[model samples]
Target chain A: MSHPSPRRTRDPARKQAAILAAARAVFAERGYENATIREIARRAGVTHGLVVLHFSTKEQLFVAATTPDPESLFKGVLDDDVTKLPERIAASFVHRMEASDGADPVIALIRSAAGDQQAAKALLQTLQQTAVDGYARVLDIPDLATRVNMMGAHLIGVAFSRYVLADGPVAAMSPDELIARLTTTIRTILFD
Target chain B: MSHPSPRRTRDPARKQAAILAAARAVFAERGYENATIREIARRAGVTHGLVVLHFSTKEQLFVAATTPDPESLFKGVLDDDVTKLPERIAASFVHRMEASDGADPVIALIRSAAGDQQAAKALLQTLQQTAVDGYARVLDIPDLATRVNMMGAHLIGVAFSRYVLADGPVAAMSPDELIARLTTTIRTILFD
Candidate 1:
């Protein structure tokens, strides 16, 4: 029997990704409480049922949308070489955030979390478990959790000011300058 | 001439102060766009007409509310003694923020500005002219604006995480630890 054409088959992975991309956009614009499944589906050019099938609920979709793929985002930044890890991580983070065409998912997550206690708790737990814990494990330093936490606060603060808030001097700075300047502060946190 | 009973006489300054205080609380709670004059008037225990007479419009009220009293907040942090400026600033900021029983006007301004371009622009301008310029004047460094900007980002980031987002480790950090750790990072940004 002749197999159906590959193009004719619906790729679940591709469909899910489309839904997530739309969800991210919607969530970023409207925040979690205001974003609706129908709106996300409309943005994705998919049926509402398809989105529901993939994400099950708005909270599920939100969690999926806001959650960063830490491995991909931090590629090699958390590796064996603890030296320059701060610089590398800061560079990678700023690069990723600046590369985004619209609101960064982290900013969206933060904005959404600000209005919702439950979402905020989940977001913090996810960050602690994923990024913070990963950094601690890779670095294997004493009081690594606190270090990672401080590092995150610094990075997020810069990101919030530069990207989210669009502060004048911050937004005016070139990416290289930001990475370089931020690296110095990050280094102190990680090393000092 | 004997002044009429202070309680009966319309003390414009006292009335204005009450209205501004109420505006700050309302703005902090609902943000600028969402906050209403009627609500602010109600909170201030005055008539809506009185609020309008005092501030003219919600926009004006917001500007008034979010504006920090620089002298109270900055104090000696912006003085000629630049050696401990970072530590002093960090300490004063954290102390003021922690001491507040309700939403911080700075945090409220930030959250409120996130969605409003005009508000964001005004906020940035205020910071540049106030905190940044103050630091530049005191520090006398060529790149003092950038340095102060970085310091702001770091302090805001820590404040945002610890107070706004209530990140676990950041919030769990004792005031002394938070101040000490943040002072170190701020020192790097300011002097290093």
Candidate 2:
């Protein structure tokens, strides 16, 4: 029998990356409960068994898709000077939403969580503990958890209304205007 | 022909009010699409046919249930002095949420809208025009529409996170504290 081609045994790392990218897109579009492993595998150009082998379960795949690298999401905002943190964080969130063509993964996660109790719990934990709690410590303000939570809720609300709901006036505002408006609000919550 | 009893000929207005109340509860619990006409009728102690006679269709019933008297929702917030508008609005929203035991009609509307495109469009129109735009006109500030929309989004986010998702820190925050923090954020958005 002829030996299998080397191309057929391509890099495992590249294959895994492709699967993850496909999972994010699929989950973002159809949500966690509605998105199936088969569809994700098809989108990734891999077999269903391969997806199962990698992610093990739909929940695991969902967690992978929605919980992107926290560093990537927060980036320089976390390490910046304390006083200017609000502006930097606001700018970073707005820039991230713009870069993604206004379909932030966090919004998708929130939307998906609306229908499922377990999903909602997962989202709350991810956001409250992993995201907001960490930022609260870095800021080192009294009652910072409440402040961080409120700020996050406001930012998420803006994203949902402006991007997902596509409210006319909100969607019409320029990026500079949005960043400025958001920075003001964030400053009030974080510093004031 | 024998005359019918006066009790059998119940007051149409009273019956209509009962039906609407039941519709609100059912729709709030089960959402617009998931709630059935029969269940609403059962809750109202009326026949399904009577519900149809009053509301015409499921869509109409949903509209009636969610679109409570605007004055009831906003109360005195719209007419308050511009300087105290933020605190008044924030207090009113938080108070309404507490009054409803966290199952506010607006939150129900938002949850229903998450799964249906038509429902989402209807909600956006109701919120943007009937609520935010009206508040914007009252405020008379430049870009007040954006401000009102952002405020609405933030309040909605807080309600969802605190009441719907029941986030620990958000849920634990007292109404006074919640209103206070929200007032500061609203002030930043509206005035700063």
lDDT of 2 by residue, B1-192 (tens): 266433243778777877887877777676555678999888777899999988898877777777757767667887757889888888998888888853466677556644554665566567667766568657777777777777777876787677777776777899999999888888887787
CAPRI-style class, candidate 1? medium
Tens-place lDDT digits, model 1, residues B1-192: 476532343778867777788777776666555678998877776789988887787777777777777677677677776787868887888888898744566676555643554664576567556787566567777887878777777776776677776767888988988889878888888888
Poorest stretch of ten by lDDT in candidate 1 chain B: B1-10
Assess the local accuracy of residue B155 in candidate 1 as a C-alpha lDDT between 0 and 100: 70
Q: After superposing candidate 1, which stretches have Cα over 4 Å from the reference? A: A1-11, A49-57, B1-9
Q: Report backbone clashes per prediction.
A: 0, 0
Per-residue lDDT, model 1, residue A183, is 85
Determine the backbone clash count of candidate 2. Answer: 0
User: What are the TM-scores, per candidate, against the unseen true structure?
Assistant: 0.89, 0.85
Residue A178 displacement (Å), model 1: 0.7
